[model samples]
Target: MSSKSDTIQVGMTNTFACSYLPEQQEQLLVLQENTLNVELFEQLLTLGFRRSGETLYKPHCPNCRACQPIRIPVKHFSASRRQKRTLKHNRDLSWSIVNTTSDEHYQLYQQYIEQRHHDGPMYPPSRAQYDNFIQCAWHQPQLIEVRDNKELIGVAITDVLPNSLSAIYSFFSPTQEKRSMGSLMILIQCRIAKLMGKDFLYLGYQIDASRKMNYKKAYQPYEILTANGWQQSE
Candidate 1:
């Protein structure tokens, strides 16, 4: 559940300011729901809303709104040569969705954190912690799986909103590091969006200059939300 004390603030931003930085941080009420129907979610996602815990928040910050909700313009997206190769590398893979968590997922997640983000939160997440982070009761799962020969290789947990999909978290077997599986999973989602005729991908925060968060910017022809409205960042 989101804290009632949660708040956002916005202000003037220089060219170097982050995309999420808003010029007018305003207050907007948070919505708590036990479930989000898929059709209704599509609408909210298009409007820039994201759900965390049991709370849903759009870009409701004070004096700022630069962090625009973004989605992959899938119909227009082209896989780079490298992305295509990555897809081919995992061609032996296929996937299916399952309800509830699995020990295999938890183990891969722990390995991913320990190897790629030793300092991240899931390094030692308990079962409850993992559930709260990925299997929240508020949102139905829109998970994607990447596997080969029926052996699971990766997981991308997302929540589908009205206009776009919110990628909450993803992980892979660190042992499969050579596969570029993380990027490949994202590429798969872009195709899924295109097939579904969705307009955006809603990649969360892309902290400018943060090495760990840098990859989010490559989805060119995308827009960044600001005080005025969604503006192309291309």
Candidate 2:
């Protein structure tokens, strides 16, 4: 690794198969520093970097421009009528944010992955994988746990930064498809970010070609990081 500063070092990983698109390869510019603080990580996010466990990476694909980093300008975000309905429908569920992971969270994650993501890379979930993927040595991500009365239903693993909150990953009960817990989790993050006086909610990469990912556009007034800089969606 090459030191860029006292608190940041940089490196690049060899090209690997793209996880979000089929038959496409991906390369990443990575931050390989120890004890990364929130302030530095927040700066990285603005530059299109995301955290996977303790590592921070930005897509460096040579041929493709499909992965666009996106964020919501919280103060300007207004919920669509459909999104408003989603909030009203699931108003019975309560959410609490915490800084640690638990056995219950892992169990829900395993069930969600096995049921909803069996065809993806994260299939056949295990505790070791969960720990390595969700927990980081330098950053303690917040877990937004959603419960229906007394039953655990969803979790949003989030990285809280100096001026924004990054929605790292979210999973929910596969059986409750009608509840749209995935969308609900994101809405909750937006609400939390607004409440915390944050200006933006960093939502990782928005790949318009992928059916699973294209929905990110639904969060209107969002900005996509481009060569010209952060461009607002029409």
Leading candidate by TM-score: 2
Give Cα-based local distance difference scores for all models: 0.66, 0.90
Misplaced by over 4 Å in model 2 are 1-7
Q: Write model 2 residue lDDT over 1-234, tens digit each, in one string.
A: 356455455788898888888778899998867768789899889899999988899989878889999999988899999999999999899999988999999999999999889988888899999999888878899999999997889999998888999999998888779998888999999999999999999999999888888888898889999998999988
Off-target runs (Cα >4 Å) in candidate 1 are 1-48, 57-68
Highest lDDT scorer: 2
lDDT at position 89, candidate 1:
82
lDDT for model 2 comes to 0.90
Q: How far is candidate 2 from the true structure (C-alpha RMSD, Å)?
A: 1.9
